[model samples]
Target chain A: MANGSGEVVRNRQVIFRDYVSGSPEETDMEVRESALELRVPEGSNGVLVRNLYLSCDPYMRIRMRKLDVPSYRESFQPGSPIIGYGVARVLESGHPNFKKGDLIWGITGWEEYSLITEPETCFKIEHIDVPLSYYTGLLGMPGMTAYVGFFKVCSPKKGETVFISAASGAVGQLVGQFAKLVGCYVVGSAGSKEKVDLLKNKFGFDDAFNYKEELDLDATLKRYFPEGIDIYFENVGGKMLDAVLLNMKLRGRIAACGMISQYNLEQPEGICNLMNLILKQVRMEGFVVSDYYHLYLKFLETVLPQIKEGKIVYVEDIAKGLENGPAALVGLFSGHNVGKQVIMVSRE
Target chain B: MANGSGEVVRNRQVIFRDYVSGSPEETDMEVRESALELRVPEGSNGVLVRNLYLSCDPYMRIRMRKLDVPSYRESFQPGSPIIGYGVARVLESGHPNFKKGDLIWGITGWEEYSLITEPETCFKIEHIDVPLSYYTGLLGMPGMTAYVGFFKVCSPKKGETVFISAASGAVGQLVGQFAKLVGCYVVGSAGSKEKVDLLKNKFGFDDAFNYKEELDLDATLKRYFPEGIDIYFENVGGKMLDAVLLNMKLRGRIAACGMISQYNLEQPEGICNLMNLILKQVRMEGFVVSDYYHLYLKFLETVLPQIKEGKIVYVEDIAKGLENGPAALVGLFSGHNVGKQVIMVSRE
Candidate 1:
């Protein structure tokens, strides 16, 4: 149905209900209709964006909680549209830089059409040759996270041994490729055999292992990293983190990206091998990609050409329509999504 | 009781019995009186040194345990004389570098006299105008530890805020002084009120607190470092380390020297604030003083002049004779010492 003021017709979105505890159920979100216009009013200093792809990241799980606990970003409040990074096209803009038909990627709402007032953080997609969907993943937050965490945080040198956890995921896959580009011996661990194969065959990681099959993580790490790990990009925390700590070499560097394992847990497991940090003289650092936004142009310069030349490859797990968005997002916890989990909300 | 022959008396050291669990008792060491000798064997490539002052450190407690825990240095074998850094006068030497009556410091036994075979690790104390006993404390391992851990490891910059734990101990006192020398706003935590005063009065620490008296360590750190901590020299781990982690500023650095609280306990406390590292982009590193041992001569050059001018001060809790050595050594865990704990086996 059309709006009373003669605006284009649109469906109102249902925001996720209050913060979820334990594993989030599909029932957490409720679809509610709203009497709102999708188009920006005349002289309004707002950009009306139609989100094409919404990124489902592990960091979002932290935001769903009530309190700010062990997270870089602020927690999401109840009865609000959960905010995340998304790839959107400007349908109408009252701002100068952004115009109709311009593709932009940055912070947007989880709904179909978002009225963005603070357009300072948004960036126009100058290079449109690549798939527009890549903006949701490989060319966006996940890509930057991999770049900064691996190169800037770890300071990896040539011939250094690198280990990446969740190596077939959006961020982990890019980290593995970056390490390989820098001439590092890279090894990765994934939850399934298919992801393990993807790490080795698709991303070009030196070695890959299915953590599901490996009963002893310590022994598995010892087998892969015989000389010990020089750089560890920690994505999945808990037991994997504990195992990686034991495998770190002298003066090793750890870039703490995300702790996917402990996100759903009531009480995270204790890591005992932390004393090894002192013995090995290791350096452990944790960082957020948002903090390194200033380096976006520099990162683009390094990563863009590689993508154009087919030197860098990316994979995505896309779900069609807003109807399937909830299922696609919830699939992440179970390692159901193969790569970057993206929801295609609309083409318009 | 002098031998008819012109010979030097030597005592074969009492060895600390194989690793003991829990608190070590005097029964752990067996002193064999029959090991005493009155002569230096002819044509031996070894120095007969009369032991003087022996330095006992908390790290020795870890070495005393036979378990194969990861340590920068190897553990002391059971039925072996527990070796520690000590100052002694060489009565006779077959090595050309060390001559008779030359004062030196290196790994030595907890006995009256010992035959030093490997003299390469030992350094001759040429400038012995001051008390030679100082070599076992201020001029020895503990001094190098404070110097390197603060200057080299943490890389403190002027006008930066620095926080140190165990501020009045062997290494912490010197670290505080060094931070003060580098123009850093230095704050320190000690086990007692007296040591806290010593940090402010003697060591020139900018602020001091008795951790035992402070109800909330996080509040104490916040009070001291209103601008937040730029550098944290971690000596005591567990709750103190966790609190420091929370109060760290953006891009802050933490140098982990020791975790005395966790060493004795069977179960170390879990750290829950690691997410702060991610938010602040903080770097936490662990290092051993031995890793930077090559800077010894350079360290002596910088620290000696400071000592001579009384710009750098050192204090020691000395126990006369080997009889009270056990109690003095054990005093570290209980915070019984004011500064460096040194056991005097004999007078020069």
Candidate 2:
């Protein structure tokens, strides 16, 4: 396949090598060259996208494994281009939902060009006043997840104490902002001092803590949430979740969005204090953003104005080029990057 | 002061010797005598009552231990009269909700006589056609818990598969019946063959299993619930919960009522398959009946008619006297009781 001008160009893709058990490494995926198909196939209902920004989310880690348990989404097939959320510009289309030059964000390959057969899956970028990279972080899947998890699942009440784990990341940062928007007292936990500072200073969290530095998570939770946690937006599960369970107030709600810490582990840790749920009459709910995608338009309406007003902010960590996609994704587990991590594939 | 006739009697009381750890023993409590002044005090809106039926619930075990974590309810005070739910005949009343000879059920001392300052806490028994002991099991706290936990928390729909742990116990029995009432296919797990037989033959469960006899609980659950459990009425929450978590269907709901197994353990068992929640989009919620007391009337309305029509039945394992209350309550831990464990103190 070649460009419309009949000149050959290379498409570099990050391909999954094999299923992994523990922490995934950059070497687990290989950067390979593929035929550049610059145009949508003739008589084919597909949109040819030049991928711009690829999202490096924690959920991707789970996809890299040979999922023995049932999951909302499928694992990445071995020896295939690792699929993830990305921002792209349509170069050609045979689908009615999209056409040439339409900017969109949805599931795409970790590569330069993707022939998206189902263009309807991608949302059209009507509001582009913000940075185009924002589509991969604040305006896309992560944004909607934070929206539904905090507002829909947790069901925030004004003046409630909201605690978000992994609080400096893409979804957590948005949840913290949303909690504050609803007049909640918000606290966050991040892994490093840099991420901790980002949570408190940049995101305006009521309190922030570096979980790694805190020797006693339970005591740390007590310090930040003296009264008790009304809502806990769970990201990193395992011990953090166990500690949070101990701190939850009567009738508290847990929005279990991700269990990143346990995802790569051979065994997910025992969450003791679960009896606290019955004692406090708490509600712990796990949700997937895909289940609530119909509310995307509503979420955009709620978040866009706040983003425009500067009341809500999003910070992104950018990795240049598709060659670095594996490292960018692997970085999420180590907390190497602050805020949302996205790999830059192409300017267009 | 006496029961309207002005006679004083000795009140035999079960007092907590000290805060216990792990499974509570009969020696942890002392059956002693107290002054039985069965009369409402002057200037007090309290009700004086002669206890009749004392309930021996699994939750009583949690109350015996000194809770290191903050709990919704307080632990039993050392050297104080052990409190429990009971049916009583009011000897005197300074509260408008009660009067002499009024039969009521709620929190009471594990003694022959008790002065209840909060008269409003007791529910006045209007229907007495059922065995009076039934008030301690079917018509009282356990009944309400089963009703709220199964119906309110689980939100059952017809044809859903329901599983209950501790199936022959107070709450589990009612949950199974409630599932059947809702047109759900119900399965339950109990410890003994007797209880298992009761669950299937007597209580109309679609199937029942003796969990103690099963080598692999997960396999047993799969055998019972071939499709998958849509609702799990969680009563025993250690290894059983871990197994149930694996067998839950997509969008399944777990109503966490009690964790009798974990309550005694220094460490609650590691619930390994919690990732299944994200995988199946299951919702696990814990509840206390006190929160849903407002629904008691609604529950009774739904249950009483069924009881009258012979569509529902209740079984009570009665401990004949208050002197045996300690053993009766302790028996719950060993799965000795084949049905709802109740201590019969007085018939009237």
Which digits, one per residue and each the tens of the lDDT, describe model 2 over residues A55-153?
999988888878765557788999989998899998877787887889999999888888887778889999988888888888899999999999889
lDDT of 2 at B170: 94
- Fraction of true interface contacts that also occur in model 2: 0.81
Per-residue alpha-carbon lDDT of model 1 for B1-348, expressed as tens digits? Answer: 112345544464557777766776667776654354533456666676889999988888777776554557777777767788899998777788888888899888788887777877888897876777788877888888888888887888999999989889899999989998889999899998899889999889988999999889888887888778999998878889888877998888998888887777666677766666766788888888777778989998998898889999988989997777777877888899999999888886
- Per-residue C-alpha lDDT of model 2 across residues B176-275, encoded as one tens digit per residue: 9989888999999899888989999889999988888899998998888888999999999889999888888989999999999987787788777777
State fnat for each of the candidate structures: 0.66, 0.81
Clashing pairs in 2: none
Report how far residue A6 has shifted in candidate 2, in Å.
Answer: 7.6
> How much lDDT does candidate 1 score?
0.83
The number of the candidate with the highest TM-score is: 2
Q: Give the TM-score of candidate 1 (chain A).
A: 0.95
Query: Model 2: runs farther than 4 Å from truth?
Result: A1-8, B1-5, B68-70
Query: What are the per-model DockQ values?
Result: 0.55, 0.76
Residue B176 in model 2: lDDT: 94
